[model samples]
Target: MSTNFDEQQWRAELEGHRDHKDDFFATERQSPIPADQRDAFDGLSYFDPDPAYRVEASIDPIDSDDTITMETTVETEQEYERVARLAFELADEERTLVAYSGVTQGGDSLFVPFRDKTTGQQTYGAGRYMEFEVDGEVTAADTVVLDFNLAYHPFCAYNDAFACPLPPEENWLDVPIEAGEKLPDA
Candidate 1:
């Protein structure tokens, strides 16, 4: 049985992850903010929590063994196995996004990279990413909860030292997704 996600709990967890020393947002590490400037770093900026951006999507499994090559900011391509397409509604409009898995290794998690109207203005220009793990095969009968509130910027958005895959054109959304991470101060 699937349980509904508690927004408070999820937000708290994100905060914890950011504050933890070994976590991605750790000030001492590869944070987007320069180490000398990190002393003033509080946390990432985010749009207010809105449940409207959270919706359920049906999985449309891909039958072919097609591979998608996504170009990175560093001019290199990363291969991902196109696993499925997630169809859902956002802002009263029907939309779809392709789901992918690592081409080298099979895992329970799926990666979704996307660009929204908010890209380059309020969020990462290259796009943001969301990932979730599923139990067993992802069939049409499986309804996955897609929470835009969980969307995050790629590591490359912070530091150029990191390489991140850019979102494919197929995954770009015309609508503004005002939830999740916002661009860090310049």
Candidate 2:
């Protein structure tokens, strides 16, 4: 696919997504409630969040094809050293914390996977997240996008037999991420 994404194309894709969402719920009979809240399924729904965002654009190294990692410089005198130490440890373990700018909100920011207050209790046990950076064109490490509304579940959510990225601690958000795919029925 071409790297150039025009505004028109993006708009079309968004419209198509809305159409797909309608079709998906029309045929998929499973409601959006846990067994405990069988009656409340009518109230719960996926796509409850709006997609509007404050865009930020920037670039970071691609850690891995499946998992992209972005490195951020911790700026405070005390925090800088602390984060640097953490980065070293992560490198030692071959675990990278890359700032992914492809997903954006509130400005181009890094999107990291994380477990949150909802993990294992209200939402997916693995948890979900969205992130953002300052808004601008992506070049090197200038900025990136982080849209939390897009925090989603892996294919395993649809079926039980797959391993997926259980969101890590750093990726967790204090707020409810009311976007993307919701947990499949248990």
For candidate 1, lDDT tens digit of each residue in 1-186?
Answer: 136668687777755654462244654565665676566657777777777888888888988888999999899999998988999988888999999998986887999999999999999889999998767777634778888877988878767877799999999999999987888652
Question: Which portions of model 1 miss their true places by more than 4 Å?
Answer: 1-24, 27-37
| TM-scores, all models, native as reference | 0.85, 0.43
Error of 1 at 76 (Å): 0.5
Tens-place lDDT digits, model 2, residues 1-186: 125635566556645664565454344545222335443334223454443421233344444433333232122111111010012111123222334433222244444555545556556765554444433433334333444455655434434544444443454445444455455442
The Cα local distance difference test for each model comes to 0.82, 0.41
* Best lDDT among the predictions, by candidate number: 1
Query: Stretches of candidate 2 above 4 Å error?
Result: 1-12, 18-45, 52-111, 129-139, 184-186
